[model samples]
Target chain A: MHISPTPQDFLDQSLLLIQARPKTTRITTTYSTTSPSLRAKKTALWLAKKGKPTPPTTTTISPPTPTTAPTTPQQHTAHLTLKTYDPVSGTTIQFVTREIRDVGRLVGVLGRAARGMGGVKTQPDTVMSDAPVPTPTPTPTPNQAVLHVAEADVPRVGSPAPTAARIGTPGPGGEKQQQQHQQQAGGSGGAQGKGKKKKGKK
Target chain B: MHQQLLSNEEFFQKLGLLFATTTKQELGSVFLTQKRLTPYDQNPEKSDTKPQEDTLADLALAETPGPVLVRATNGASKQNRDTKKIKFSTLIEPDAVDAFYVRYAEVCKSGMTALKKKNRRRKNKKKASKATKTEGASA
Candidate 1:
């Protein structure tokens, strides 16, 4: 059976190193002659920009001179190094390589792995632990509010006027019904009068 | 002395063995370096005499194929100074570099035995919880 090494064992055995450097390629170009016509055109444009009159075309143009300059182009390469040590044989070995792509993702993975093996606590964990636990405050639900009102008004359950007054204010349909009832019993005034009398008696 | 180029399989096997032998007390670190490769023509004067087409072709041919160089070293500690230090460097093909990273990452994440132990503990906990539920229902 192939037994896999533990993370701690792997951490102890190996080290990873990723280094980034800019690779520069230099290319030298030799120009045998600068084009006389092109140079003259450039001179004419410069004179115009400077608000000066253009020179006559009859003026002799200088011959092209040979010039050489080296141009360098730079690109980035990531070098990855892995070092491992053997305890049984007492031998240490190292491996190094350069990679041109996916350097960011590779570094991120390796960082996470190293932190895991080292048992390093991350910032987010410490922040979460230090934060206070939010205590839930009681919020009055619609049903609970109704129940509380009902309980308080239990003593006045025998009086219909007070009960109707309280219920009619909450519901539009109940208020309409109360209004129609008052209109039908024009002599009795309204439930409001009865609610007032009940309050007085209490 | 001539250095022998190790095949990919041989390199991986040696890497695995090295990892297998390392103990927990040792420290592991990773250093990443990125750089650009610039190709320089040695004979600029000679190239000037050649045709423009030939120079262009030469530039194309001179372009170096980017190869990843990997070097591994083991046992450089003060305590292990008496032991022999083994160091090997190899050029890895670009296509195979991804495989190497994946393997290295896997080894770093966790060991197979540790995962198995965790799974066994979880199973035992589940079984115990089930037995308690059955006992409560019976009582």
Candidate 2:
């Protein structure tokens, strides 16, 4: 039941982040910072003749609502862009609009590559065999995250857990969740422990 | 009401017959495999003749099919049968282990060849294993 982050959350979170900012000069972590998907994309793009600098990778693509036109990635299309008041007072950090389609395409490609890795790519007929079983959904996402997002040199998978915003300590019951999680194991995994105890009692 | 009741009876009888036919079709391979492998049917009339004929040839072929397991009064006699139905499946035991491994290796080689086109890095695997990425190029 992990709900994806909606558009408004991005704006709200950005505002909150800006508000919390000190008058600190943000050292722009250049594209040089390690990120696999970004490097892979750049490498792949360069390999494909797309050239250097893959889309300035974003942790979130706030699904644009009807009103906002769009934001472009530094290299590709960025759906939602965030530029803060420059670290210095009175100056602004501005980024050119990026294309959404580019980011989406790369995300899709990387997701596919990450998904198909290992001996995990079952033949279509084999996949059909698992259709009757209720368990295959969770099997793919985590591996995708681990390989692409968490892997060293490219932390594309390090982007927030796609389900982090909704089923979290974010809503009204945030504290209650924190308490329950701490009392148990913490988080979605901990949430299952309660069911385990109930079943154990039964 | 009397006419409807008669129709219902006729319909149920037809449905039952249809079910029997479909079940045979669905489980036909499984039943044939069982018949060939299991000796519970010492009574020849109970077993189908086609499977018995194929079972011997099936065993002698490249892969041995499943054994017909029987509960004998004294002990069981298992004649290793060659098979066609479950050729891709059917685990190999110790007796046929070496032969199975050789066949399996060939199959693996063929599988690798088929995968070659889509396998981005297979040829590079040898070099990739010895590959080092200069460790800190960006640094």
Candidate 3:
């Protein structure tokens, strides 16, 4: 009769079996497809969402937590392929990058591309300068009435009456003319209420 | 055959690191791929026509946690037989990633809501047509 394998032999075999099994699987995929405008809109929208409070329901959509996975500090190359079609050329172009920073750049470029800025060679400063800046104009609300003040007739420090600023040519003579004209109009218009009583007395 | 040299564990770990750095430092990558496809290719059984690549379905954004990948495709080229490959790599500033993540949840929510609304509209249209058909038959 042949001798059977010992407990140590069984343990050793188990260890070997554990070592033989593959530790990791091949590729996992996550992908989305949308028009350039929609992508840009999403990007812009997401950006705007940063400062605002995120709802609890949104927790469902948050990416899966990586902490659950076993990980170690190591460097590995990932094949990131990005393809876009050139309408002018009638061909599709695929871009690949391993650098994380490069991916960020690609996104920036994609975002720009989404905004209808066709690929043109330009420096960062130049690109920024070229983009149109949206300046907000102060529009008067329906409830609010803007008091118009003429520049030429603005009240002087010593001279005590409030008047519209003189709007014409800037000069001492021009200012004086405006002031005189304003005084005549004021004198005529002031013949009301208290002013009427004072004029009658005079 | 092993196309990528890195071990799966190591590769995943690196990907984890990529996400970590990206999320923490607010820097991420964008990957893009574009391919040509025909209109009949989507449902070959339904259309008994040759794949001429007439319809273009370009631009797909892969939902990877590490980096954003935009895959762009266009209709087939009649004259050009060879596929074009473009590899553009550069370092991106932090702002882009920040914007992406900030709006990520909202965009996903809105997209889902929009899809739901579209389905609802379709259902309503179908129901209304059915009711009108029944009424017409009775009359």
Candidate 4:
């Protein structure tokens, strides 16, 4: 027997479907060259026709609803992707952009309504199965020896120990440095004077 | 319009004359002969000796011989009331007359910058001299 549906039943269903629509879509073909404002205005216009009060605006434009999709900002995103969202029409927006991670998160929240043979309760494991496995973190072995070595390695920290061989009038650091320089100059001159007389003189 | 209240064009012209004078001139005769303006003046009592103070009708005939549009221009002073000049133009059209004003403003700005630099140099020299004097005194 063919069953007739009531008008209330049809309207309620339509409203439900409209509410379920996703808000944005991605296009794989990159159009980053185009103005983002224009694309957003166009999307806002499309949404406005679907009973939204106003279309999206370019400069700090308010979204029709709290869950409005944010336009892709700067940074190279997934290319050659197409995502279409229609919150009012209940369209499942396709996203070709690599911001797929966001879509996966949404899906995670609202999992498949029915699954298995006779609609079994969704297990946490099933929902997590689609999620990317996080890389296991290795136990950080703090090198106690390395910490000591690093503390010892700071060149500025070990600066207090100036050799007696480095003392003289300085602009603060001059005393330590001038003595070292004078000793080096004296030693070098003695070596050179001895060599010059013995070797080149003959 | 003047001493006669509405018929003395001579006196009205004299009023305009006093207004245009370079030096402030007093018209004791006009104020003294003029009857104090009052509602009773319009009662036809006429004070028997005088009529009334200057009304809209009288002043219109006073300031202007014919059709005169009262306008304030040339930054008319409020303290110097009882006289006004007429202006009929937006005069400062950006495209037409403002270019000279803009250029003049730019010149003024450049002059200001030069003056500031000169002042700064003078200040630096003064400070240096003061510093030298202090150092010599200390020594």
| Per-prediction TM-score | 0.26, 0.13, 0.19, 0.13
What TM-score does candidate 3 reach?
A: 0.19
lDDT ranking from best candidate downward: 1, 3, 4, 2
Task: Tell me the TM-score of model 4.
Answer: 0.13
Which runs in model 3 stand beyond 4 Å of their true positions?
Answer: A1-75, A86-89, A117-202, B1-139
Off by over 4 Å in 1: A1-202, B1-5, B23-65, B73-76, B80-86, B98-121, B135-139
Report the lDDT tens digits of candidate 2 across residue range A1-202. Answer: 1111433443343333233332121211011112233546557767567554455545454532211223211221112222323232343442221223222332222222112211122237866776766655455476786775555444346576445544664776877777887866556676698789999999
TM-score of chain A of each: 0.21, 0.16, 0.21, 0.17
lDDT of 3 by residue, B1-139 (tens): 1122243234333343333332222122322231111122466444334323222211111111122222212212458524322122122222344444234323323322111122434555666667677768888
- The TM-score leader among the candidates is 1
Q: State the lDDT at A43 in candidate 2.
A: 70
Docking class of 3: incorrect
Q: Which residue runs of candidate 2 sit more than 4 Å off their true CA positions? A: A1-202, B1-36, B39-94, B116-139
lDDT of 3 by residue, A1-202 (tens): 1111332332233222212211110111122223334445566678678865433433543222232122222222233444443332233333443333333444444443322211122236877888989999577565443332343345557764543343434578878888999999888777666777887899
In candidate 1, residue B130 scores what lDDT?
72
- Displacement of residue A32 (Cα, Å) in model 2 is 40
